[model samples]
Target: MSHLHIRPKEAGADKRIINITPESANWQFVGFEVVMLEADDTLVVNTQNTELCAVIISGVADVTTQEQLFSNIGHRASAFDGIAPYAVYAPPKQELTINALTSLEVALCRAPAKGLYPVKLITPQDCVTMTRGSGTNLRHIRNIMMDNVDAERLLITEVITPSGHWSSYPPHKHDTDAIPQESALEETYYHKLNPKQGFAFQRVYTDDRSIDETISVEHNSVVTVPKGYHPVGTPHGYELYYLNVMAGPKREWIFHNDPDHAWIVNP
Candidate 1:
């Protein structure tokens, strides 16, 4: 709808956005955008009590975390005591510098496990679980040794869909603990455009033919999962990127889609 939305409570409310700041650092319950640099510049960051997983969305920078120095282009970094201290140096000529943080300036954004969960940079070599069932080339980042942690409540997956094809097309929902056969944990969707200048469509609502809601999604947009089946659509001219976050009481994240459309899994 607007630039962004945030669903603070898990009720049936719409999404909202919160401005990013270093002093008020907290986990974003839905998600937040962190602007690292305006142009070729340097940024010194100070974290409070929150751990941060900063993913380099665009542009290049020389990042220094603790005693380790990560330099050059196309790199991501994670910091446990991100609330402690970190520094970044942007490259010459690159205009925009943005980094997506796991938890930022929010109250409910979840954090990594209690044990030693190392911060890792995902690479093409680390892409695992290439599945064909989802009608796209879906690779995941959770199975890695560095990404696996006990306090990590969210699982991030990346999907590349062909133009005119579907990714999360079947429309599914996981809103209860009814049974493993039909129930699942709640989830959140964060989208990114492949062309870096395109948009897609998404649908979320009850299956009983009541309470239907459709959202026109673009890059840096977010959708919420309350208690209904949701399906994502990618247009013929554009590809898509979506990050899913899930949590529940059973300590396991699972789901169940609409029954009639569930047959799409076979076709």
Candidate 2:
């Protein structure tokens, strides 16, 4: 199976640009898509068997469900603006209508649902932003829906790697179900570059080097991690941003870092 999945930006398409399901990526639990809507446009979303988290990349939108309506729910101009994003979670079997208040760009992160959870709107105030690593390896991490959140199996977050730096450093893997040490989770990285022309590199590999690949990722690229330690790097002049969606047997994140680079995290 191909470990690296790349979906380029498709212009003049309907609203959905990148659509990734478990069958499409050959993964078990993770699914993701990016949608761009013009002003006043509307789209109906149904979470049939999967629970979805809709993240506002830019512009304003009113997301209405049978239980609640989230109006004027975005404030950032772009993902690179370093501002907290607006997001909403819809449980499985729920139907939602997204009305574009402005030209909107949104990301739909999904996973199979085992139980129905309450619909929650995760605003900027609900996000936890922190800086990770030190010096050149420093990067910004935004925890949108973490394990602490009341969710079934999805963990969503965003990472921003400054120019000339690395995010997801110390290459980590969560492919084994080793209890507190590591939990088996399938993950997907949906990436966006600062200048749209800029690019980034991602390496997914295993200890035996049996599963290994170094991918060149551009704007609107989606990278899937079936089982490996994955690391990402941005070039000298360009910044990199990516949204991570993960789900598996457990609802927590327990990972093991590459021993060769684990010292960096300690030292």
Candidate 3:
């Protein structure tokens, strides 16, 4: 098992498939988890010293925090349904409760914070949907919680890659704390395939090849990138959807493209 590739845990009553803590990864900044809930089930998130973003990836749920109640926060049944998801962000020292109105799949993204923001619901309309690249490099992106949002240190997004296409293309890295040039952020990719049985591929590597490996990613798999230009690819028939959670010393996203592949973006 490559350090970068992660499979979910065995099914439990709670169905929290993937759980990645910063301590578990030996990387500071990003902590992520995904859970599947049955209708009427409930989950409680205690935010201690970190802020959280609970993304209602699919199905309906009522997400409530001390400061807000985001009721019936989802609609699509699957991540690949072409619908931007509903998410809720809550600050530190609070508890966010999620009660499923229908079967649900939610992602919990966490990062260190100073309690600077209140709980807020991020509607689909608030997300920016855009198409990037052309040809095989083409992909769709939904900015769930990006720079435009007011968060102390979390940048979240979702991407849908068509079958046989590439995403996070032109391989980019943000591992150097160069401010306007590049920001060091640890990232986690939670992936899902349309058919649920198909697989995708992701490569994580640094410029020097010191940390290079290509991973075969199965449905619900997670790939963590601590420092590298990571890119993803889906096979000919399986469309891919992934939720990305990023956080580090800086909250902004400023990545430097791999010099060798820089032309793909420039040309």
Candidate 4:
């Protein structure tokens, strides 16, 4: 376990209107909110009660929601939902300087409103890359929010396991519901680590009383998922990233494991 969980953009609790709905890890359910904006931040204007989707995990930011006004655009990773008296401007607070650096600290992931889902933007060449075992390497980012096509929870992926590799492999669980094949989903794992450093070993239980718990994640660590049958391990070297929040009732995220390890899913 490398261990890293950094959240210091500075906003302890001045209230100033920050409901989040009640999910935890800085509000985890109505939509999602993993906010962090430094340099000369200003997040006022609640928009009558929250409705935002800000995502720019790097530097440079200047936004003024309610309708318009955006300068410098949304830095690197961009995603902004809608309808809000939103406002975020950061600059020169002391000679803004962050050039060519890889990952030293930068994040702004929020989701409070959007028709109920369907807002995606995954870069890293769209990610499909995967290298197995303990020396794991992976990248899977998804966002299908909701389509209501039956809408139980269609898709939402963000899994990047680099350094030591291995991700929720060989251990699966869907809870129940077997019709077309298998269907059940309820998962949430939000962890981010690059230079923030180490720690990554998560394993939920269920193998006949299996109730194991080991969580030592850093860099905005977050792991909460009621059921069991979870899997995520990256030990050998390090390098791990996570942001795979899911919802279920039945849209499609089938699962069926615990059958003698299911033959390790063959290769």
Candidate 5:
């Protein structure tokens, strides 16, 4: 398997599906994990030196930070439910706990921090929903912790692409630190399909083709984009959903589209 393509291990209902750290990814920032929990089960997160953002992918969860209680924190039985989720952010060196009020699925996104921020509960009301592209390029986006939100090193979001649609389209890249033009950000795409048995396609490549892979992504799998113009497509029958975790030397998310495919955006 290519280092960028990560497959999930066989997991039971109450187990972590995927876990990636900066050391494991050979990158400077970005860490991700997915977990499933039965009702009343709990998980304690040791933030260490990294900030943590826990996004409830499904079911309800209660988050506790120090003395604060953020309760009943989620909606929708699936990401395809067309609703935004609840997210909790915990600062570095601190610990937070998640108590699953119901069967829960959550994604933990992390990055290095200086302990400058506080624990914050980002509700669906705090998120901005926008639809990008049109026709077969159409996709729905939930901007959970983008630039407008208060966070030091994370720019998180979730996207839903309808069947017969494309997403992260026009083949965009953000591997350069040229501030005005593009920002260098390492990203991960954690994908899930409506039917557990269905699959999707994602392509990661550079202008020089130094890194190129067209992956058949199964449910709960992830694709790491260290540097490339990455784009995704869904099969005609399966709706696609993905959570994106991005971070880098800076926190900006400016990207440049591939010139060869830029014309599509103009028409």
Candidate 6:
């Protein structure tokens, strides 16, 4: 199966821009969708049997759930704004109605859940924004809902790589649960380019080169990593942004980096 899945802007139908489920991606866990809503428009979302993280990529929206209501929960004009975006989490069986106060773009990340966690509205202050790597490998990461967060099996975050830099550098893989070394997890990347016409390159491969692919991704592209070491690079003159969704048997973010290039992280 192809690891790279692209969903172009014009491919959206009925406000659903991108949709990926366990059955669609052929993964046991993790699913995602990108939704666009016009001003004053509303959409009802049911978590059903999965836990979901709804991230507001752009514009303001009011999210109403059975327990509480979040009014005007977003403010970033675009994904490239360098501002921390707002996100909401809902556990299984919860229903949420979202009313767009302006033209909005929301990313829904889902994963199978066995317990019902409380609904949470993750504001900008709640996010942990950090810089990773160094020099040419520098990138910004926004941990929206991490392991410390109250969730059953989902981890959500976003990363921004400047031009000519690497984001998921050193080629990391977490397809096994080798405690203190790595944890098995399924992941997906939903990408967006600054100029829209620009593109980036991503490589998904295994240590033995059994499964390897170098994919060229553009705006609104989605890439799934079932099991492999994945790394991405942004070309000069273009910035790259990707929303990352991950899920697995364990609620941890441990990973093992490629031994060959592991020195890059230290040197």
Stretches off by above 4 angstroms in model 2 are 1-3, 9-14
lDDT of 1 by residue, 98-130 (tens): 222232211122323332334434443453434
lDDT of 6: 0.89
lDDT for residue 219 in candidate 5, whole number 0-100: 91
If scored against the real structure, what TM-score would every candidate get?
A: 0.61, 0.96, 0.98, 0.28, 0.97, 0.96
Residue-by-residue lDDT tens digits, candidate 2, 124-199: 8889999988899999988999953678889999999999999888899999988888999999999999988999
Q: lDDT of candidate 4?
A: 0.46
lDDT of each: 0.46, 0.89, 0.92, 0.46, 0.92, 0.89
Candidate 5 error regions (>4 Å): 12-14
Candidate 6 at residue 158, lDDT? 91
Candidate 4: RMSD to truth = 16.8
lDDT of 3 by residue, 190-251 (tens): 99998999999999999889999999999999999999999999999999999999999978
Give every collision pair in model 3: none
Clashes of 5: 0
In model 3, the worst 10-residue window by lDDT is: 6-15
lDDT score, candidate 1, position 77: 33
Q: After superposition, how far is residue 5 of candidate 6 from its true place, in Å?
A: 2.3
Worst 10 residues of 4 by lDDT: 78-87
Q: Summarize candidate 6's per-residue lDDT along 65-165 as a digit string, tens digits.
A: 88999998999999999888999998889998999999999998999997567899999989989999789999999989985477988988899999999
Give candidate 3's whole-model lDDT.
Answer: 0.92
